[model samples]
Target: MDKIQRNERLSVIIKTLCDNPNKVFTLGYFSEMFGSAKSTISEDLDLLQKTFKKNSMGNICTIAGASGGVKYIPSVSEMDVRETLEELAKELSHPDRILSGGFLYMLDIIYNPKWVNKVAMIFATKFSGLGIDCVITVETKGIPIAFATAQYLNVPLVIVRHNNEATDGASVNINYASGSAKKIQTMVLPMKSLKRNSKILFIDDFMKAGGTSKGIIELANQFDSKVVGIGVMIETGLPVKKLVGNYHSLMKLNTSEMQENNSIDIKPNI
Candidate 1:
């Protein structure tokens, strides 16, 4: 076999690490693949780490010990976070994006791969230190972002549903009051969805009064899990207090003004 060049090895290494964030890749594995010495691979990783840090392109973390190797830790710099949120606020502030019920039309943003991946990176970066076991969200709109976050965090994604599915087997159901509408809503999670004593991270597209987040907390309790972190793409401003505390939101939406004036008044919360 022809020997792989240094540049070729570096490119493949960066691609692999970025593609599978937070996943450990043993040095022996890479050494065997590249037909190179472990010391050579370590030097390459050092170069990549310095480049990533200098360019603000996340991190390449090297794990020590016999079972350790390297992994990508996705992160957004403060300047980048502010810039992204500002751009999002601008895009969502357009009058056409405002819906009838004082809700900002952000389905397109949350569903778009470009935006979804970026926002998910922000969420994953914020909660990266939590030792999160899984990322959880309700069914429907929040799935995309939640899934992306789970990918970055290198954990499973758990989805709670409004109704139980026959295919889900036995499930645990809980009713919690909606923070915005003040109406009761049912949340369903399968019994086998989570293991006991797991730490969960909740990700959602929007938060009115954090009813959904609160519901997620209650549901996590059923499985003997705890919600260690909560992250939402956008949160309303009216509710000075939310049902759940200690959440990170990228953007703040002024629903009242948006409803009254038919214009968006949103800003970055970072």
Candidate 2:
């Protein structure tokens, strides 16, 4: 095989590192792959790290040891996050996005990879330092955000179902009140989905009065697991007394601002 040049090597290394974030890649591996010396690969990494830092793109952390290597951490600048969420807030404030039952139409945003990833990163960043064993979210809209958070944290994703799909096998079922609907609902989680004493991180698309989060806490208790954190993309500002108190929200949905013209206020909780 022909020895790869400098530019090509840098590009390939960056791509490879990005494809496996939070995973270490040894200097020797790169050197062997490109038939370059360890020293040359080190120089290439230094340049790559510097470029990433300079552009505020992300981070490449280098560990110093015989077994040490580099790990990629995808980071989005706070300024960029603020700007993007502010735009999302504006978009969400649209009257058409408001449904009859006071729910926001979010299927489009939840399905959009661009927006979903950004939102997930925000949640993942908040809970990254915690000892999270796996990411959890209920069925429907929360799946995408939960998956993205799990991706960034390099953890497994556990989904709770509104009903027993039967494919999950023997499951533990619990009835919890819906915060917004104020009605009791059944949420089921497979018995094998989580281990006892595991630390869990809950990610959801919306939080009304925290009924769902409270339910999740109870459900986690059934398995003897601890819920380390709860994150919601959008939370209602009113009805201040929520069933669950501890949670991080990316955006605050202020329905009080709903005017006759049909404009709701959206604000970034950052």
Candidate 3:
């Protein structure tokens, strides 16, 4: 076999790290894979680490020990995040997207892979350091965002069902008022989806009165897991008081002016 040149090894190593972010790979693995010496692999990793930092591509953490290895973390700059969200806010603020009862139509953006990936990047950057066990979301529109986040964070995803289904056996259900509508609704989670005390991050497409988030909090409790953080794509401004506390939103929507003026108030959370 031809010896792998430094440039060739570097490219493959970067791809490997990016593909498996947050997963540790020892120098031994790389040495064997590329038929290189430990010293050479170490040098390559060092250069990759510097490149990641210089380009703001994220981080390559080095752990030293018998079981030590390198772990990749994906990140985006604050400036990039601000610019992206500002643009997204404008697109979502269109008057035609407004629905009855002050809710903005977010299905389009959430379903949009390009937009949702950016939203996921924002959340993943915010919560990546939290050592999250999994990314969890309630069923429906939030699935895409949560899945993307889980992908970047290199963690598993757990999706809660809005209704208990026969397919998912032994589910834990909870009742909470639907946001803004003030209608009581039930949501469910399966027993096998989570382990006790698992640190989870709850993500969603929107948060009005924070009812769904609150209910998600309770649902997580049934599994004895803790929600370390909560993130939403958009939140309502009218019902200023939210049932849940200490959460993050990508944008705040002011619905009052939407109907009459065909205008919207979108506040950037970045």
Q: Which is the leading candidate under lDDT?
A: 1
Report the number of the highest-TM-score candidate. 1
**What lDDT tens digits, residue by residue, belong to model 2 across residues 203-223?**
999888999999999999999
Global lDDT of model 3: 0.88
* TM-score: model 3 vs. ground truth: 0.94
Model 2 lDDT on a 0 to 1 scale: 0.87
Model 1 Cα lDDT, one tens digit per residue, 1-270: 224588899999999999899999999988999889999999999999999999999999999999999999999998989899999888988889877787677788888999999999989889998899999999899999999999999999999999989999999999999998999999999898889999999999989998999899988888888999999988888798998889988888888898788888899995
Model 3 pairs whose backbones collide: none
Quick one: ranking by TM-score, best first? 1, 3, 2
Q: Give TM-scores for every candidate, taking all chains together and pairing residue i with residue i.
A: 0.96, 0.91, 0.94
**Model 3 agreement with the true structure over 82-198: per-residue lDDT tens digits:** 999999988987778878865577788999999999999999999988989999998888999999999999899999887888888888888888877889898888888888999
Candidate number that wins on TM-score, 1 or 3 = 1
Which clashing pairs does model 2 show?
none
Q: Which residue runs of candidate 1 sit more than 4 Å off their true CA positions?
A: 1-4
